[model samples]
Target: MAASWSELMLSKLVGRCNNFFQPGSSRAMCKPFMVGDQQVGWVWPGVEKHIQRFPDVFMVEDKQVSLCPSLQMYEERTARVQEVMVKLREEGEFIALKGWRDEMYEVFHQRSSPPVFRMERTATALLGVKQYGVHVNGYVEHPQKGPLMWIGRRAKNKSTYPGKLDQVTAGGFTAGLTAQEVLVKECAEEANIPQDIALTAQPAGAISYFYEDERGLFPEIQFVFDLKLPLDFQPVNTDGEVSEFYLWDMDKVKEQIAQPDFKPNCAMVVLDFLIRHGHIHPDQEPRYLQFLENLHKTLF
Candidate 1:
């Protein structure tokens, strides 16, 4: 029998979620990247061979990768790592480093503890380190139509996910910024939203997944936010990252996410929104429980 549209959508959403969490046998082949006895990330064989050249900076042995113990201080370690990263970047070694933004991300054993060192944001992925980001789900309560969400289309020129659908406002969490700081900055920079309006965005928890691709391993967490925008408000892209915005009803948003155009991670964020707001209920969706559980995988 042909599956109904609702059933098909649920199946697709679950499939997408499953894909993001599947690291497969690739993870077993990579070496755990460690610093001060704590594993901070993973080192792929290709990157591992290159870093092995810098013996003064890295120590790869015993089926694991670690920074040289002599580089003890945080600054010292970060500087040494940066030097190796620069050499790799100049050589155009990894595809992940090509779009380097000059932004940095901290390397931590866990989210609560202090970072051991920092590395270029792009390299974090190449090394299989977890990345963090903020995603805002902007919506309005229409007097007549109920709730409507604001979605963005990535600019065609974007280096990644060009012309794909994404959240209303999103930005990666860099080395020194807090989640709220990234949230407010992205709201204004991506959507031209003012600070006062952006401040009202409430914390909407987070979603995490461990996904791998040709670029590298992505064990990522996106801190989510919900912004209740005024009915008359419109989002204009200040940055070229986003090409356009759409005010979509819940059904429309659901339908589009089922297709391939929506960025995978962003689709998970929207699915989280729908589940939290009752747009998708346990009574109707057979995969409701599984979706809630798998969307927030424990990467560590």
Candidate 2:
């Protein structure tokens, strides 16, 4: 019995997703990024070398990379980090710094606690810091054809994941904003979804993963939302971030996600949706439990 395309694709997606969760070896190699006793992030080898230059601001030891304990104030710590990031950007020390937007991301020891400091958005991944984003699964339930999803094709001009398929609307959770706030903003900016309609989106929990590549480490959490649109509603790309949009049936979506064209993270969002909507059943999927476990990995 040869494996069906759906079976093969599901297996492949699970394997790809597994890669993000298996950061045991890489995590061991990276130094803990600490503030006082709390480990906020991980410092990659290259970033560790650069932070070593600023001994006054960063106290780099063999076991860990830490912000100087003397800098107690949040503003002081933020300014000090920004100074180092600016210097690195000026000297072209890191490829990630090249895309330095003025955007900031607040870094916290724990999600519920106050931020220790804020840093440039792009530098977060380079430091192996945890990043949060919102991904909305916009779909319409047709009476005859069943549920169809609205998928966005990222614009070619975008710095990352250009020309790839993505969620209908998505955006990073920036400094001082809640996940719901981001969802509303992204809904309008990315897909022209009205605020009233966007507000109706149900919170679908979250999925997290940790992965390392040549650029650096990614400890990412995507806060997922599900919005069922009216049968006649269509998503328009207001922001140039998305070039086009497609309304795909579940089978087509499954096939597309199995291919390289779809963004990996967004594919996970879709997979989670399928499972929650009873599209992917436990009786049918051999690795059902494993898939559920892989979707939500612990990351601090």
Query: How does model 2 score by TM-score?
Result: 0.94
For candidate 2, write residues 73-171 as lDDT tens digits: 999999998999899899997878888889999898888889999999998877788988999999999999999999999999998878999999999
Name the runs in model 1 displaced over 4 angstroms.
1-25
Candidate 2, superposed: residue stretches over 4 Å from native? 1-25
Write the residue-wise lDDT of candidate 1 on 102-133 in tens digits.
Answer: 99998888889888889999889777888999
What C-alpha root-mean-square deviation, in Å, does candidate 1 show against the real structure?
A: 2.1
TM-score of 1: 0.94
Query: Model 1 misses residue 4 by how many Å?
Result: 6.2
What do the candidate models score in CA lDDT, each in turn? 0.85, 0.85
